[model samples]
Target: MSDGLPMRVPAPGLPARVRIHEVGPRDGLQNEPGTVPTEVKAEFIRRLAGAGLGTVEATSFVHPKWVPQLADAERLYPLVSGLDVRLPVLVPNERGLERALALGAREVAVFASATESFSRANLNRTVDEALAMFEPVVARAKAEGLAVRGYLSMCFGDPWEGPVPLAQVVRVTRRLADLGCDELSLGDTIGVATPGHVTALLTALDEAGLPASRLAVHFHDTYGQALANTLAALQHGVTTVDASAGGLGGCPYAKSATGNLATEDLVWMLHGLGIETGVDLGRLTATSVWMAEELGRPSPSRTVRALSHKE
Candidate 1:
């Protein structure tokens, strides 16, 4: 056995401490064509909480024209507000921020894309313009005593704009950090990132004086590389990760983008590595299976599939 600092050997294992932010309720349902009823969304959140997830992306405050599924943010937030968890809502601009604050959102996430093409597609604005727009929202949210998390989407690659420059990622990250946001999440939006790319990017950030504690990694499993990328980040000392239950969600804008790294799959990897995710893998698996049945699709989590087969 190895001694001190829980190092991941060539063989598989869990990390020492792992924090999973469940995004199934928001990210998982956002891209689906059919609008999931608010009650169903609340039920998903309830199951996740019962499964021991501490942080959940509960909803988005975008207008109905953009993401009609989350138009019921106001309706859903109050229903689950009393839970013992952090419910982070994604706010697109000052209007979104105002709505979140009015509803008493404790924490919020502001998003920016590292690639110009994606920024244009997702936000209908350039990278710089989107950041400029969110500046006041971040300020106002902070003024309202809300915690802000910054999302840097397409950190690794963009469909229209090939590989994103590390410098661009750094610039966006710094901008968010300087704007008084609490944490920054680097998203492998299209799931094109590999282990080496993760290491390179994190290392560059470290070299640039950005500590890992204030950072999280959001990865998609499009190329089936999400777990590998998670391990790479764990080895580099990342403590927090973003995942969805049942491997739900895909980018409506990114044609090739797939669902996020499944929470069950990520928890399986973390538990194997001795990481404490405060999540029950068995319960999470059951939840994913149930969700798949609810969605009328096959479960996307490899770990869930394997466990179900064994039973």
Candidate 2:
């Protein structure tokens, strides 16, 4: 899709190395019932780093009232500061960015929805306005020497809107790219995307002139298509992915939504295919087990449940 590059499919093997951005610490805890204590959150990050994840989304800097679970972001940030891994936090606005900057965050992420209805409902703004909101935040983050990652949620389909246009997804991603975001994560937030849809979207993105190296894929398993869609993206040249440990988080606003693609499951598949994620399987499993115990519930990862049965 780029100039002079044949958009042909990749060979039938996984890449030698892949980067897993662990979102279990932040995205996983956002939907849980009780507020996970700062100590527990810090331990969670430590455990994830021990599992060999290079990048971990530590916490969100949103208002406490909006998400009470991550209210102690200030406390949590400093606790993970000494870790060797890249710690990124989600900053939704100027206030959130201020908090993150105070915490000495080296990386910050901002999100926008692809569909108009989802954008208005989730961010309380239209698509264009939501895009506009991140311009200043991206600028400020870059000014502070922080790497900015942008997320385009519901890139495949929206529950209320259904069947999003590829052109719209491309436009939003391009805008985010132009805003100086170092990486742009394309998210199937509701997990309604299939392999065909995934490939088609990547093709469209490639044609739209967005560099493949700057893109990452985030999928949910609502329809059990997360891994299949990921494989499709891999074949199309995606190296970074967003997955939650134990498949922990789902959007509270979407009644039909399910948890994200489990990190344990993704790592297992990558290992089986001879791909290197640099994650310790046993430690990753232990982290999921800890989260399950903290929440007093079963893990949503099929691989976790299956592996637990053997032990």
Candidate 3:
């Protein structure tokens, strides 16, 4: 309390360290109404890495027509590529993959949907069709010696489809894993998941031969259950968590989507639980606050607000 830090109480049966997959640059800015300048985005990535986020998603290679906010992926990646961290980019298909590969991206992620409705809405392809599209992208990335991550959105619920079945999620995840994805990020895209749902999904994944080691969790905060679902994931042995700085990003395709779990908030909880993330809390909070100013709004992260106001 004296140092303005949460009292550490190490949680039992939790990983001692969690790798936060910072998604602010790519996922966070994709839905922004205004264009964030390429230099500003490069600076954001620099600040995130300076704050000790080891794995930062630099940008996406999606067509500018689809995500104008990140249209400068070509420019942004070059600016931050020199930073000493793992920089991943999302590739929608072989074209996107080639764009990232041309820029020398070492790690690439492909986005998929666990529900038919989301698949059709987001990718303009059915669930099976979308997977077919990503098949070669993942294969090409792996063949090039690049690490591939599969992002499975709507694993918990879909805006159009309501509750997604456990079996449906497992099937998609298994196929992604089978397609040479090094890791799979299970996304509660609409922020509708609870602790119990998280537990059941993880258990099913485990039973289906997809262990927690190759899994990550991405939760939105539409219902304020992001942290609780995250805690459940930690208890279940999933170490990688996808978070956006300052609680940024929402699904532009999903009508009910909201901001993601903020990096500051997730860092606060992890540090409070005595889990090592290697992130400098003060520096990370400052980074978020700086980013909020760039975006012309206050940070939605409770921890960012609390810590910044305390100063």
Best by lDDT: 3
Off by over 4 Å in 1: 1-15
Candidate 1 root-mean-square deviation in Å: 3.8
Candidate 3 lDDT over 158-192, as tens digits, reads 88878999999999999999999999999999899
Q: What is the C-alpha lDDT of each candidate?
A: 0.88, 0.88, 0.93
- Model 1, 223-246: lDDT tens digits are 999999999998888999999998
- C-alpha TM-scores of all predictions: 0.94, 0.95, 0.98
Of models 1 and 3, which has the larger lDDT? 3
Q: lDDT tens digits, residues 88-124, model 2?
A: 9999999999999987898999988888999998899
Off by over 4 Å in 2: 1-13
True-structure lDDT of candidate 1: 0.88
For each of the candidates, the C-alpha root-mean-square deviation to the true structure, in angstroms, is 3.8, 6.1, 0.8
Q: Rank the candidates by TM-score, best first.
A: 3, 2, 1
Off by over 4 Å in 3: none
Where does candidate 2 have its weakest 10-residue lDDT segment? 1-10
